[model samples]
Target: MVSLVASSFMQVACAADSEGTSPNNQDKPASSWDDISDKLKVATTKGLSKLSWGLEWLGYKSGFGEQCTFVEHPSLAVRKHLQANLKAQDRAVDVLVASIEAWERTHAKDHAPLVLALTGPTGTGKTESSNLLAEALFKWTKRLDHSDKDSPSGLLVFRGEDFSDNYTNPVSQYQEQIKSRLAEHLFRCSGKALVVFDEVQKVIPHTLDVLTSAMSSNAHLTYHRGGVERRIDTADVVFLLISDIGVAKMEQLLIQYDDRRHVPATQLENDVKRALDAQWTRLQFGKMVRQVVPFLPFEPQHIVLVIQAKLDQLSEYYQGVYWKSLAFDPALAPHLSTLESMLYIERRAVVRGVDVRKVFAKYGARNVETGPLQQLKSKLMRYARPWNPEAQFTVRLMPDERTIEIVACVEARANDQDKANEDGGGGAIDTLSCVSRWQGEFT
Candidate 1:
């Protein structure tokens, strides 16, 4: 564990060293190491200066804590995200937003935090909704940290899967990390920060015990930093545990209901409460949490909305890309949307059990692939490929062999249309696809 921490720092040192280089900047005057280091320090902080060093060892740009003067208020896009993506979760969203806003308004000198537990089955927007909330309050999703599943930030994340095996790394090491981070963030934020333990069910009881002091209202946490046990205050920090423990069975239990869209919030909350009871009791941290908000299994209508929302995200993303009218072929969107909806649910209450982001991520060239996926990946335009600067894109998935075809249509540019036509491959559907049976959908 210590070695892991050291390696993380080493990576940061490597990044700092590389910042001084440039292939073409050799002609430019080079700044002294001190000047460069100061500039790098300024750049390393991505707006949030108060809590910058919490993740300094990791070399990622840092975020400001809650109490930091530079933190941003929620954006319109974040509000729109909540309004568009989350359905039938009005209760949860309302409570969360209300509480956080209230916390922000309070003038109390002492610390008091709002703790929430977001529980639900897969693909029901629990995480997305949380992101929406975070974005609204924090200005950007990246500042929330661990938003990418594995990151360091004021919004600390504990993956339950990793914590389940304490034998591999001493739990005390993790405890130390969590304790120090929480203390730093809370102090920076004036006793307020969001800490998430995702996939909470996978964490062992003893490991969770580490969080008790941090969760308690007293905000007292005890851990050894330098062979000395130290205490810190966490009273202003909000703790959110995202759990999927009883969600599968809960879906099964709700299958007989006819009006799936209107599952009572109280009823869903109760279900989450029941599932969390056994573990909370075993872990002895049941009373610390303020509320259990259930993310119900996505219904067909929910899936439909989610798919459209996801597609819009894709469209909005590539819309700004250099030279292309990027869009899901209107003809093909319906088919892909249908497939996305089918993937979210299960036998009783299921939807795409997987995140749709992974699909959108396939377009990036950085990731490695194998077999036909690799072949399909190879079809993409390289970083510097030049077929036609004024080309448009339409994404299409052929029915068989799980083929995804990127259809690029070169458009007539006033200056180059004649040249384009003369060169051939002109004004036609240029197909980029691979041959393969992509069986990535849920069985």
Candidate 2:
């Protein structure tokens, strides 16, 4: 910011002095007022832009990128986010932050991407925590769009299971495909890039073997095509590998130590690392990890917190962007119920792994793609089971299913006064009770 301010001032000063006549000159040419005026306009615009940016940096303005960075230590910000959004990973948070910081510093000179492996249980925030690191560096995490065939440059996402199924694709061909696809993105990006590999456990050893070459001293993958070596640069990149490889086992380990309360991070890290290492070894994926951040299973309470965070987020979003006249109950219709009951419902939903934001989107009350809530909405969608918006649904229970469907989407008839009157002023159910997590799978 200091350099930016100084640069702006210099440009202004240079522009002002470019056509000025000397005061002592005997004969002087007429100065073009238009040119001077244009310079002033440009200078003012640039100055104001810089000034606004400075204000944002100084906390006087709310700008997109400003609030996401580290004030001094990025780890502090990362910790703050995790402590607030996640639970029972205080030690993991420190290790993760320290790992990333250490890797970045060393990798700048080493000329290879720093690779991190995040292993954890299903609902734990391993991926979300990685994203916190992403936001710290890039001001915002650039999400890879699956819908678009053309991925946005610099950020590429690979899902492990996509290349799985040996019957469908031969291992040799799959390996080549993985290498070539990754190489394509790596070469296209200028300078450093961030590539995230999610569900790493599902990826076959042959496909992940591409990493051995990518993480080499030269930091480039070599592929022989037509008897010529073609190289793709990956030296100046960051690779985050997220997996549930030992997740179930890790969860079991943590549960064994649940009552200990003061279990050391080093011990937890070691145990989880062993579990993940066993998986990696069993899968025959050779060692390539510089750091391993093990995300433990969140206590059921933590899921409640994450769900509550989502609720608070929605409240803020609606406050900021709610259309004044558009009122027909919030996406959470039973908000009119007692606050205690409403909270109970929300918490129960969280325990059930029901993402309320997706529920909102399901009812058409929320347009998830067009607001600040998109990130939260996206995360919620991941846990959401598919539901048809147009089809009429029933509330009856099926004995064949293990998971209970809590279908509560009721369109308001307030807009249609006739229907409202017929139903005795909108017959909305307000009863909310907690249900235990289903022990088995349900469709």
For each candidate, C-alpha RMSD in Å? 14.5, 14.5
For model 1, how does the per-residue alpha-carbon lDDT over 93-118 read when each residue is reduced to its tens digit?
66566656665565255465667788
**lDDT (Cα, tens digit) per residue for candidate 2, span 187-277:** 5444356678888787765667766768656788877667788877777666888887665455444444434256666776677778877
Off by over 4 Å in 1: 1-81, 84-92, 102-110, 128-132, 139-153, 166-174, 184-190, 222-231, 320-322, 337-389, 395-443
Clashing residue pairs, candidate 2?
A: none
Candidate 2 regions off by >4 Å?
1-88, 139-153, 223-228, 256-261, 323-443
